[model samples]
Target: MSDTAPTAARTEAQTMLIAFDGSPEARRALTYAAEFLRPRRVEILTAWEPVHRQAARAVSMSGLRQADWSPSGEGEDPAYTEARETCREGVNLAESLGLQPRAHMVECATSIWSAIVDAAKELRVDLIVSGTRATSGFRGFWQTSTSENVIQNCGVPVFVVPPAEEEPDADC
Candidate 1:
């Protein structure tokens, strides 16, 4: 018998929540998480705005008449479908990295950042990994970075991977 008291062993692997939008930046973030963070369990999330909601916003902004738009019961929304596909791709990437991955799709009811934060809270993940588009200038000012927003709102630790830098011109 050992002199030291035996400590409880951790049975479950550490879980990480990754925010993926099918973008190159998001893919890089996932790769970074797998290679550096080395999380054993991962949840890949794709947050998307509903088609109808997008149309409504477009109408409101453009002063166009709102058309009667409803989801067809026979088919899924393209936005949701795309989100699912993106999540699948992320899952595949994670699996290739040798980490167990699950896919999650969440509607951007309020904001994409909010959706990510809520999902993180619900999943009870150890960390949140996201990619930034690195928007700047007027557009950046008007549309706040999703990674920045998630970092500000979420209680969990957030790892934001920025887009790869462009190579300098050889002619210059």
Candidate 2:
């Protein structure tokens, strides 16, 4: 027999939650997770915020009531449907890559990052995967990027895939 050594053991992620928003960046994150992590349990989460709309009734000068609004949809909030659809796409993509993934849609009136962090905690995922379109300069400082927020707030390990850079237009 040859004197060859065995390769080191590979570390596996037991459970991973992928933040999917049906965006290109999100898809890239999912793709990275599928190719690299390939966790036994994959959770695809899509968070949606409801749109605020004022009630149709006329407002009285004496008092003002809370605005009545829901997501745009037929009978149900459309945001829910969109979130579900986004999750479905993520699940299908992951499944196609031979991973068994579950889809989850969370509705939140606040920040989407908060929802993602909450889900990760509740699911007890070993890792959280997300895509980042890193912003720079003044806007980046003023705005709290979702991926950065998740990374900062999440307790579990977070894997972030930065969006691929596009080549500058020659005409410019």
Instruction: Give me the overall lDDT of model 1.
Output: 0.88
lDDT of 1 by residue, 1-172 (tens): 5545432333145568999998999999999988987777889998999888888987998998898877675688888888888889999999998989989999989789999999999998878999999999999988889999998999878999999999999999
Residue pairs in candidate 2 whose N, alpha carbon or C atoms collide under 3 angstroms: none
**For candidate 2, lDDT tens digit of each residue in 12-120?**
4467899999999999998988887756568889988754422322343336765655545468665566778888999998888888888888876568899999988
- Supply candidate 1's per-residue lDDT for 121: 90
lDDT measured at residue 68 in model 2 versus the true structure, 0 to 100? 57
Q: Which 10-residue span in candidate 1 carries the lowest summed lDDT?
A: 3-12
Relative to the true structure, how large is the alpha-carbon lDDT of every model? 0.88, 0.80
Looking at model 1, the pairs that clash are none
Best candidate (score: lDDT): 1
